[model samples]
Target: MGTGPAPGRERFLAGAAEVGLQVDVVARAAAGSLAEAASLLGISPADIVKSLVVKHKDGTFLFALIPGDRQISWPKLRALVGVNKLSLPPADVALDATGYERGTITPLGSTHPWPVYADAAITGKRISMGAGAHGYSAFVDADALTAALRAVVADISDPN
Candidate 1:
């Protein structure tokens, strides 16, 4: 674990352990967005899995994992989620729901166990994801990650 008392990191690690998933945390100096973080890590953005929080018209929150090199397709996501409308939640609302800020939101360690939907295009043996803290990310086997997070794989991403 990196320095600082990031509750998100704590919760994420705990969840990973609970699911018996081994993960490696890579700490960097300072990087905000997925592009910056990928650059700092010297890896392609496609290897970075970004956790996105989407809210339905009924105010229900869901998690979507998309490759950093791609973007979420709003129409496809709404249809997959069976919602009339879907939009990003406010920063504070996202943090309240996931226990992490915008730049460090992880599907794991959420305040509530929200459903996780992963893009089918993100196929790889391993991948990196935010560790519920900025400047930190976790590398884990893709299968282990999806299994641990209980993510549903779907085609909900638009190629970059």
Candidate 2:
């Protein structure tokens, strides 16, 4: 109702700061796709990091930080997480798990602080990712962001 940071934005800023990481929050218009969002941010689509939330059969969650031009490799992700079954939870389930809606989900300020798995391509690059809100994103040093989240970087994504 009020014009302020989104639900998890404030906490994300605090947490990033505590870890000596600087993240720049950018306001954007609602975008219908990754390419559109990239255009709005004046960056290449590859620079966008998509924080996709996935659920395991055991009821746990994980954040897959894939590049905008890629898609998660189910085999790689499952093997990395040591799970045979994983699923993309519904919007409500995702919000309940991470305290952010589907399109606005980020691992930065998640209510549950779930484990983050990032694509190796994102390392040592500047990336823009959801900032726990729709029409908003954060630009950050990939290494710092991954380190702050203690994310496991691996070849878990495929070219989309």
Candidate 3:
């Protein structure tokens, strides 16, 4: 599930439309931190989300959508995933798995539709996250995103 060519803009947009998920794609520059990025984007830190790819020992993977203001609570996520061990795969491994670089990984255009887990705190907000490419972000309603991906909504993160 972690080996394949990266998908491009075509697939990214296509996947979103296929799932009936409305997204607003915007260009962005590198920032020192999430807060700075949000500030530059004229949004709150909570609006900036991170898509974390968790690798299981069995080689399967899952997507953890965490708000910038919070972090993945390993114990909570572990329990939800019912796994004893999970890790952030190396950059190369992650790229191979989802066809997107670490900074631009998104399930919207991932090579495989790995299970997605979204933190409940973000459910009713509009959030921005990786858009399958560097220098870009995808803004979407969390509810729509969760529904589109059929994500498991839970308390998988802790305030940062």
Best by TM-score: 2
Error of 3 at 142 (Å): 0.4
lDDT of 3: 0.87
On residues 1-160, what C-alpha lDDT tens digit does candidate 1 reach at each position? 5656466788888878878889998888787567888888888899988889988688778899999999999988888888778889889999887778887888777787888899987756578888887778888887778877778888999988
Flag clash pairs in model 1: none
Q: Give the alpha carbon lDDT tens digit for every residue of 11-125 in model 3.
A: 6777899899999988788777779889888999988889999998899999999999999999999999898899999999888888888877888978999999999999899
Give the TM-score comparing model 1 with the true structure, all chains together: 0.91
Please give the CA lDDT of all the candidate structures: 0.84, 0.88, 0.87
TM-score of 2: 0.93
lDDT of 3 at 24: 93
Which candidate, 1 or 2, would have the higher TM-score against the true structure? Answer: 2
lDDT over C-alpha atoms for residue 8 of model 3: 57
Candidate 1 Cα errors over 4 Å, as ranges = 1-5
Tens-place lDDT per residue, model 2, 1-160, is: 3665555677667667777889999889999988999999999999999999999999999999999999999999999999899999998999899888877788876888889999999998999998877778899999999898899999999999
What's the TM-score of each model vs. the native?
0.91, 0.93, 0.92
